[model samples]
Target: MNKVKENSVFFVSLLLTLIFIFWGVFFTENLTKVTNAVYNGSIDYLGWVYLGTTLFFVFFSIYLLFSRYGNIRLGRRNDKPDFSTASWLAMLFGAGMGVGIVYWSVAEPVTHFTTPPYGEGYTVEAANTAMKFTFFHWGLHPWAIYTVIGLALAFFQYNKRLPAAISSAFHPILGDKIHGPIGKTIDILSIFATVFGIATSLGLGAMQVTAGMHDIFDMPNTLFVQLLVILVATILFLISINTGLERGIKFLSNAAIICSVAIMLLVLMVGPALTVIKVFFNTTGLYLSDFLQMSLRFTPFGEGEQWIASWTLFYWAWWIAWAPFVGMFIARVSRGRTIKEFVIGVLIVPTLGTCLWMSVFGGTALDLVQGDHSLAKLITQDESLSIFIFFDHLPLSTLLSILGFAVVAIYYITVADTATFVLGMLSEGGTLNPSNKIKMTWGVIQSALAAVLLLAGGLDVLQTASIAAALPFAIIMLVMSYSLLTGLKNETVMQKGNKRNTQQN
Candidate 1:
């Protein structure tokens, strides 16, 4: 009782989360109808907000890199980065977007080739458009969204000595009111977003893992199997949580990166190597040239409105929904770095790597589909089987499938472990190292949520709900960016004043 009173954020959030899971499980249809209605409404009415906010974040990150505050360290002036550059990048990349990239690397490009954002489908133009849009979705824009929140959190929580929570980022605007109901409200919203977003991902990853197992090992893909996968994955990730961040997350992240690179190399070597190189360069050029037009592209008067809403708007909302979780994880690992370095590292490195991965897998998948119409149709039927189907035409098919399966599974563990850690941190008064009991509670809750949604057929609805949550959170993110700028300007003035005082002395 004392603990519950002391940690009202955790208890209230937990109670609400349980209620949500029950509603999803017992009243799946009603939940689906409600979430879909809200989702479609958001996409129909406020889609431009998602697009414009993300575009603003991209420019905001760039401005910070060039602004006078570029040299401001996230921590104290003399503090150094706790982790090395390579490990830092791996953790952020793995936590931010590991399995989703692998799952979509082949699936999304192939989907676009068949049903593009614009123009006729399955032509050379469609394939070119596919790669260009893939780059756009997985590239700088998403990372810029993450950078906005991460930079603000790190700057305020570390540099300004505020509490390590989402509400802390608003200290410049709210002052001490950040510790009142307003702060609790922000944290609760973050918790809801984190729990549902990750639960949706867990459910999706479980389904994809089941698909991989079915394709490779001839296992049955059923609800029971998916639940079992969640059970096993829950155990693995909880074990990782127990081992803590330095040993568990770091090791898994590094391993996942290595495995991912090896898989990409194998595909490049065995697939159309020259074509991939050409497509990467050519598509990169298109991405740059079409960046501005695509950033705010919508079919207000044309036929592509459905496509824009389905793909582009949906992706923007999903990324924003995930910002709190990924942003906090990145901020936690990003102490003791300069603002400019953090922006460049976050916005550029992983994006280049992601574009290359897409060029390899997505490029190769597109190449393969040109000659095999049946394969394209099969992939269109079920995107989860995309990587497996792609591996079927290559040499060492079985080996590639197994390796791909391992990557997805490892990604599952890393992401779940990171989410567990972040949730515990948020609920435990923003402690850097939350108690094992708290982490365990969240881990089990997440697993249960995934299992319940999988069985009740509420995963898709929950995902849509997550997207709906994005509209409000995007507003919060916009305010956070302003608050961050305010704090940075104040720091600049303080530094100048201190320097002048020293000179006079």
Candidate 2:
């Protein structure tokens, strides 16, 4: 018999997810209304909680880099990183953000430019604010959330020889209870969060791919086309997962990084290069200067409250929902690095890269929108197709559009493959090498969830479902942070005691 039957975490999570997906499919209208209400209620009531927790994660990540535990390696003292620095960064960047960067890079800035948080639409100020907040949304806070989870899991799994699972991070606090109901609940929440998180991404990627196909080949942008995109992408990912991480995920990631950068460079070279460079640095500076103001900006008495709730709060919840999958993937590739190295690499590198990408893609798009308001209309019509429209105005429009489509497709595969591996691990008692059979099962579930959500109500439904699923996982992340601190403190005390005993002997 398959060990899945013996794994409560896997079996229970699968049962619950199936029930939820069935509800979503059969009662699309009711599920959509309920999920939207829950999403809004959580934002209205727990918006502050989201802001406060995200800020704490950011601060805590920085502290880990300089703390006494900084030198503690994730694995044994003599172990080195399993992958090259370039490969490691490629995987991190590709798995962590990937398709969203390409999809949102232009679309987000244009949206904010037209309806900024606190500025006139389509003006220079709105353009500047759009890029700044874009940087803020895609910046360090999200990575910090991932870092906390990744560090905790890696520390326990490698340093302390615990199972490679989110629940294991709580062992320091809950002790043996981590293996009981408490631990199972935490792992279950992680699984739900990972599935919805990846499903949302898959849905978004499908729309973008459909839009690109429409833009390039004049295909109809209908639900049927979008479902087809998801089906084909899922099949490709399932095949990719069978190759395992080393040959499949790693190769796809490296290829994605290269192709994505090429598209960015083409935009920079063909568009206003100097303007993109200037906007990037300026927006980055603004982001750092207004980091606090942006992080905690909840407008109770102002008109911008809805905007903050929709954009900022949504991004925070999405990142938290994604932390488990991304964090676990980071941990898997980051076995031999120290806490300091891992923290700095995760928190700093991907963040700066995101800023540059936003600057180039977003900057160029914003400039075009300002000059010709018609460009902004394309975005309002369909956000997914906006990038392709933006490409139409630049040099090598046809080639860049094709490249953009390829990047989205490859990113979808990378995310699905990585999620399959991580979800399999979570369900199968944290086995480092989960069965391919289990992985294929989760792969189908993920694709099914995305397809159902797409049929239910498209992007809004997808976003609402992700935010709703993320609520419990947010609490889990907070507890994980506390447990990590406790674990590190205990390790420090043990080190000192051993040092004193050796000296006395």
Candidate 3:
């Protein structure tokens, strides 16, 4: 009874907080107006902080890779990885980005192309800038954020035998204070952030799924249709959660990767294969070349402030908000790997995959718009239908559209299943295997939150909620980086002492 009560602290606090927010948004008039006011206020004042912190995360992650601590194992020295390389990569990529990749692969580039930060609209210059910035948003920086959080959690939990929770990562910084109010607060915040972050993604997935249905089946893309899509997808994910991780998530992730690769191949074959290749390399080159400029960019001059706020700053906060769920899921599946392997695998592979995906989809869209001016207008009018519209210009459009819908559906399931698992673990005091009842409860709550947010204000509400949630968590992550470094140094000294003692004996 005592143990259950202790665990209930997190779950109960999170539930009540969510209830208050839901009431504020749905019941109270002008609540969303107030929310957006606060959201835009933060972006205007603190956009530079978000950009700078993300860059710091990227640098720190790279430092961990090449530092002496790189050789430190996450688990027992003799332990081996639980899953194969292929399976591991699939899960890592799947849970890290989810349906966003599908939704934005075409939409983002086109949106950028139409209103680039520093280029004329719908010209070659804008297209170039668009692809470059899209890569910037989806590339190394986001994965680096995930790497730091996952590394901290995995190191503390596995190496030190601490509880598998966010507060555990602060052990070096707070010591036993982690068991007090501070610790509880950190965990509570993590729970809230994870729920809101996943809810936002779920909301986006529902919108895209509705658009896809409208394209393929001639269904009306209305709020009612989107809610129905959410309901059906939620049911599917709940069923998936009951099957457990290995049987459900692993299988779906691998299958999604396969399908995604197939669709990419088809696009490459059918639409501007050479141009896609050339654009990929050129965009990659530009991204790397201007990486630093892009990383620290904020318009203090007030020239392009709104553009920066809408695109770059929003992405940084969104990634920060998502860090907890993606980070914890990565830690869960990444036991027994060395710190270097973990960093490299988590940071590089998925990023490369993202670049390739954007190249195929974004590249094709750019090519079509450049060749014909009308397609650019269509893209500007409805960004949701960008992928379907891009597909219509290719051969086997019907088959590819079906495959695209399947990939999105699978990604939706993976995100919900992974979020349920992580949320259960978090609320259950970091138990390795949380109860199915808890998982089901959180899953339902997540679906409800997504539905409510969609109805309240669609993408605007979701984005604001995510940014608000990210601010505090970003501070926590900064503290976590310090804790991880301190813990690694102590481990190094302890290991050397043991080695000397063994040699003398």
Candidate 4:
């Protein structure tokens, strides 16, 4: 009790809870609507920029990793349950892919089957552009966001005397003055970015899950189901937050991965393995060959606004909203790693997961549509029902459905829990083992906030609002590029000077 008394986490948690409750009561629908407008209005070459920037970062990070910085290792480890290579990958996957696995694994693939990116001439076998599309969104650049954050924090805090936030990625150039109000401002902004980003995901994911329930079980798409999911998700988060990393988060993370993989296998056998593999190769090649052109291609402004919004803008908003949490979560797991190791494991491995997961899950869905027209109708009529309709095509529908739902349930737990856990750490100034009460507080806040948005705006409103917040943070992260470069050079030069003096003496 005393531990909870003077702690800022407790109060911050309370404040967030109140904010969520207040919004839930009155302004949720308003927030949802405003955000939607903001999101829809911003289209163009956004995907091009998102994809372009991500590619640049991926290449650039590889360059830096081979340089001297690549060799530097950081982080302080205690004997109890230290992290491993797999842990890093698991954490990265758990951070975003949990909710993502459930949501996009079906919706995205089907969306592409209907619209197929490279246009009408390509047969479904030759087309199925969704896997490539998912790969591009989920791949190297997003991981670079995480790589930069984790490397900076690991190097700064463990190797040097800096704090473990991504903003510290700039400390090498900024120097001691970074510790003043400037640092605090950056820190606060980081916190704000993380919250808004994850909030959108919470609302988006909760709504998706609710939609899934309605589709699968024929449950009414009611406010109550959304609320119940939010409430239940929050309770799980609180439990994991209190239990801390090893026991709570790890268990859920592993569970999610197992479920995800098992479902993929099931889908492959039941759906169509051969076609998805071929399409995966074809689309991946397409994604890679002209990566730069596509990444920077902001569909000509004159080209239909709706088309641009549906693809590029939506992807940009999703990535931007996800960056901070993914970045921070990557930082947390990335202590005691070299720059190269961190980048490859976090950025590369997860990209593979995204690509393959999309291939199998999305791939299977598309194959079914090609084989059976009714499958296409299910997708076009209701994106949420697409997964179950695919299930209906299978021989063992009952068993697969139970397994699929179980996977989704555990995945949601991992996502909601990890999100709340990261939030608590951010607000508490990067405490490794933050107070249980503090973690629980953020957990409850996130759950409540998500519930409100789900009830008022549904998925569209919830997701759009999160994207609106991304516009500003995008600039902030770009600014971070300058700060990181400036800081890195200064730190590097100073170290050389110190080494020279020691040799002379």
The root-mean-square deviation over C-alpha atoms between each candidate and the true structure, in angstroms, is 1.0, 1.7, 1.6, 3.7
- What would the TM-scores of all predictions be? 0.99, 0.96, 0.96, 0.87
Q: What TM-score quantifies how close candidate 2 is to the native fold?
A: 0.96
Q: Give the per-residue lDDT of model 2 (tens digit) for 174-214.
A: 99898888888988888987888888889988989999999
The runs of at least 3 residues in candidate 1 whose Cα sits more than 4 Å from the true structure, single-residue gaps closed, are none
lDDT of 4 at 70: 62
List the candidate 2 regions with Cα displacement exceeding 4 Å: 1-5, 498-505
**Index of the highest-lDDT prediction:** 1
Model 4, 88-184: lDDT tens digits are 5776788856776666677666776666655652255433456666676666666676666555565666656665555566675566756655665
> Comparing 1 and 4 by lDDT, which wins?
1
lDDT tens per residue, model 3, 85-162:
899889989998878888888878888887789858888899999999999999999999999999999998899998
Q: Which candidate gets the maximum TM-score versus the true structure?
A: 1
Candidate 3 residue 37 C-alpha distance from true site, Å: 2.7
